[model samples]
Target chain A: MADEQTTLPPDDPVRFYQVGSFAVGNRLQPLDLRTVQAAQDRPNALTCGHRACQGCGEALGARYALDAAVRATDGRLVSVNATGCLEVFSTPFPETSWRIAWLHSLFGNAPAVATGMAAGLRALGKSDVRVVAQGGDGGTVDIGFGCLSGMFERNDDVLYICYDNEAYMNTGVQRSGATPPAARTQTTQAVGPEPGNVFGQGKDVPRIAMAHEIPYVATATVADLHDLEGKVNTAMGIRGARYLHILVPCPLGWGSASKDTIAVARAATQCGLFPVFEARDGEVVASTPIRRLTPVDDYLRMQKRFAHLFAPARRDDVIDRLQAMADRNIRRYGLLEEAAR
Target chain B: MPVQIEGSQAVARAVAACRPGVICAYPISPQTHIVEGLSALVKSGELPGCEFVNVESEFAAMSTAIGASAVGARAYTATASQGLLFMVEAVYNASGLGLPIVMTVANRAIGAPINIWNDHSDTMSQRDSGWLQLYAETNQEAADLHVQAFRIAEQISLPVMVCMDGFILTHAMEVVEVPTPEQVARFLPPFHPRQVVDPDDPVSIGAMVGPEAFTEVRYLAHHRQMEALEVIPRVADEFREVFGRDSGGLVRPYRCDDAETVVIALGSVLGTLKDVVDERRARGERIGVLGITSFRPFPRDQVRDVLWNASRFISLEKAFSVGIGGIVSSQVRASLIGHPITNSTVVAGLGGRPITKASLHAMLDRSARDELEYLEFLDLDRALVQREIARTRVGTRSGPAAENMLRDLGAVRSTPH
Candidate 1:
């Protein structure tokens, strides 16, 4: 149960003993080294019997992040949620899947609400209680951005976790500020000359959070449960505004197989479309190198939203543009081994 | 102690005495000084254990108060005019969630013409938003209402909006009996939330209620406001006992007994109407004034009782329904539905236009003689309105009406560049 063993060192030889280093749990590793989800008695902050879609990455991501936060705060944690799939699915009046103290304020303002909860708790001499605000990409990157940035500028004691499922999945897959380029959404149709979401737009919220020079800012994905849980834990340890932009793939919105949620998220990171990295005070301290460099097509072909680019005369030009974006990310974050780079 | 202080400062001191745990605010005209005072008190350690948050916008201020109140903290915030409109979505959310957060809306005119002056348009816009709207007639009532607002809000578990006229009350220096902490403590008990975000007994505070339960949930909110109709007066009575002054209640009837024509108004406009009524009464005109402190939970029964025997009544409104004319008068008319009371709506003091004694004397003389229109715009520029109406009829595009009116009045250049 030592603190050192809780984090799997980069050079640990035991990483290769089982499925892989990216696996959530390893039987060969000790209890402390395993992910919180691997534990039998995890808090299950976003508990069972919710109405999320099959293989919903946001549901898993919320559970992993909040359970880890609960473990870090010793069960003294409060969650403030924005009106999104997470808030709607988890609590549907007279019933709720959330076991921890939770609140769903509005479509936006979770960050400010969490800031208030922290302040209120502190004022009441209950500083031991910690706060976490969460929302989807639509909430965090677009509608709630002002409040989130304000929380960051004030450095309020709250950890805001964004479960980024790319688009506004709750509103039936409309385009959001976090929606990737050339992705077919409800608003961004696939029949036009552009065929999907336009290029040269969409927010990079993790980078935006880093620009705030906060105490902690990290990009995580549901593909790596240990990484996501670890990031939440690290954010919980900090006393100021900490942001965790977790890339949670949506099976319903992505038009992918329900079972390929983790696989698609893994392909996103492995192809460098979504960078997994950590920053402190606006400086990149570490990044998870892609173990096997994959093409952006491997990530795109799994989802029907991008199926337009593959069929009816292959849009090699758009695919190449996407690959270029991934390459740019790889170069920017150094998300590859020396030979691959 | 009774001291001559600005209305906002007195309210801040009264709020500090009540011991709010969180005070979130965004700077807006009129309401800015209230939060500024609270911020100083918090920073200087005068108000210990209080967190003063300078939010980015009015939305964040209200949202933060929602969070603080949900977590069982005594929360407070203030806004006015467009700032109130900006935070309006959260305003409804706070009340819908039944968070007992007290907010001060320094009542001002909502803009298109863009005026920063005193009016009730802002608070009237939120008359149905489920917050208990308490209008103050003077600096003393404005300060005293804060102490009672907290108690009443906590008692019924609904948000309270303590509204005072923008610059007329918020900026005016007047004698206010600011209560002591001991008096506030005796009157307003420590917050014991009906619902709280406590880890020991974890519960979801704001859940998504579907069609099956949404109506019931809203009805419950309405039921709580009805409950406030009782709690407001009880708390105001308690405040009187503790602070030794009459402050907040549903309505304050001034010389209504044996009166024929009763004048009705809200906020600081009531002070002017009361003075005008006193002068008329001195001349043996048998006039009376009724000041409505609570706009929401509308005090229907009380209003009906006061105006029941009166032959006629005049509703002097600072805000009206624009197209429909008379926001408060409409409610007053609704309350006196069966009664055969002749009523008139006098829209006055709009956008900081001074309601001088001369104008009131003319208007009241007309009202007493039954020579007033059903919907009268007191002190309106008839020529300017006529010119604009004529221009609109002649041309398809009249530019903007506000700009045109300003130009016609020589408030701006007559020629467009």
Candidate 2:
């Protein structure tokens, strides 16, 4: 990581981006594509003064996407939230930070609830209002996955956005189906010979969503605010069940510096570890290209949960396997927006 | 106008006329015909303006309904027995979130020795859920209750579970007053969810409540359910005023005044028991019948008043409380703890076994003879129990696991069918 060095620029674009412009915060993008950040207008659709934890990536991602969605729809969007950290932290009975019409559903059934909401709105001749159903990875990839698949299969008129932080953060960091490989979670300990999580396991929901062929399926990262906002805005344009799974790194669960939220998230995409791409009907149609590919170690080294792999002298094999995974993702999705070889 | 129809068909027709925004369902034995009829209606465009989500499991069914409801729609769903238990979590949330979704539960027994018959076990399991619960005594009541559920649920911003006896109400066809779409549209206004997901007023729902506010939130649910009693009567009065019928709102009494003997029950059992009561009346017996149509509200005060003068009370239930007595029978007994009435619990007609008229008359005869037995396993034969014991040791020293192992090894003697 960055070892408490004061050699950083006087005005860190990352800090400014949260308050100023979404595009202003990046240290890796070219000057031409460097656009203003999402919070320049301080929409704060999630607002402030809720119970979200420090450096909560879900909190950040939700606020950024929702405010952008509201802006895009021009106040014609309604959010159906599933029971999870985002729902719990934002609403505290009789009080809410949300400024939009919101409906809360069960932990494992947000997709179904959102489908109902959309149907309800349509019944009332209010099809102009778009529906957004949201939940954490635990709710999305694990508990509510079946219901989510049904929504997609039926092509329900709703945009389901999964703020995936890998684990069940609200319930004390247990292992979720979306929990990354070799992650030190409470359930998946770092004790086995292969260490944390065994490879070749866990549900790859994006590919599953693609199989449904429900018009649209996209994956984004919180590191790229524009990409996330763009995907949400695009999903809203579609009439059927649209899925957006965003990788939001949790500071508490990942054991990373609170400030490294965007930085770590950026490294994940840049290293080709978490491919950012959009697919339609099971085929990859578009992707956010990685201009400069970084080493997987750069991303893994920043998080203390992955510190075990680097601590025991050196784990060349483990690191190599991680790199291989990144390579496979890069080749599979063609995430690099740059020209192909 | 009122027309004779089966309870299941009445529910199906009412749902079709109401034109729900979405219908999610999963089949469970006795409750299968309700959804099956609904599916037919949806497929034939008889029930237009709805999406019939045929889910893989009951959990998915309820979950889908929850999603549809949250989107600000009039969602309708149904389930029974294992299906009800499977979707219990979503069922609780559908109520707690105050989504005015209506669900019809066909009461049936849960299984281990796997039986698929009618019972109150399933509904009793969900008694504490915040959904406004109402039981139907006849096909007409079952049909009328669906209309009332939509009205009551929409008014209170709560989910309502309209329970009907499995097989009895579900299979039997009778005359039911079917309201026209225009009349129903007027009686039950289209659902305008109090809490909606609007972009202009962005907010979160189903938020976690810590120790600070969990109790108060649950208390609010409690207060609303209690208030359902007030809303129920008004809706029923409205139904009566429009359709000129009072079959399915709350408890209905039959010859329960100044009587020495009273029989209390719910669902179609009342119809049969009423027949036997008439038979007994012709023979100069001082017996009366009190059919409890609303089980969730329990109707404790009304129950006491109905049976207060009776010397001996008999409770017949298709479902029983395993370790105790009849579930409803026990509840009725508990309500009369301070009052008079020698109440005896008799369980009958479990797992789809037909509750015959002769059996009903026999149970009454037994109660009259002071031969009232507690925890009477309805339709349970000793030969079957012996056969089961010979095949599997459930309550034995070997335990179920050992019996299973023995069966796997072919060591246990197989019984003849």
Candidate 2 ranges with C-alpha deviation above 4 Å: A1-42, A335-337, B1-6, B39-48, B67-72, B190-192, B200-203, B386-417
lDDT of the candidates, in the order given: 0.90, 0.79
lDDT of candidate 2 vs native? 0.79
Compute DockQ for each candidate against the true complex.
0.86, 0.53
Q: Per-residue CA lDDT of candidate 1, range B1-417, in tens?
A: 789899999989989999999999899998889999999998999998999999999999999999999899999999999999999999999999889999999988888878888888999999999999999989899888988899889989999999999989999999888888988888888999999998989999889878998999999988888888888888888877777889889999999998999989998887778888888888999889999999998999999999988999999999899688988988988998878888899999898889988899999888877799999999999999999999999969889999888888877522321
Angstrom error at residue B105, model 2: 1.6
lDDT tens digits, residue span A158-264, model 2: 88899988898888888899887887888888776767766755688988999998799998888878778777777777788888888888999899999889889
| TM-score against truth, every candidate | 0.97, 0.89
What is the alpha-carbon RMSD of candidate 1 to the true structure? 2.6
Location of the lowest summed lDDT over 10 successive residues in candidate 1 chain A: A1-10
lDDT tens digits, residue span A211-283, model 1: 9999999999988888888888888888999999999999898999999898999999999999999999999
In model 1, how large is the Cα lDDT of residue A16? 58
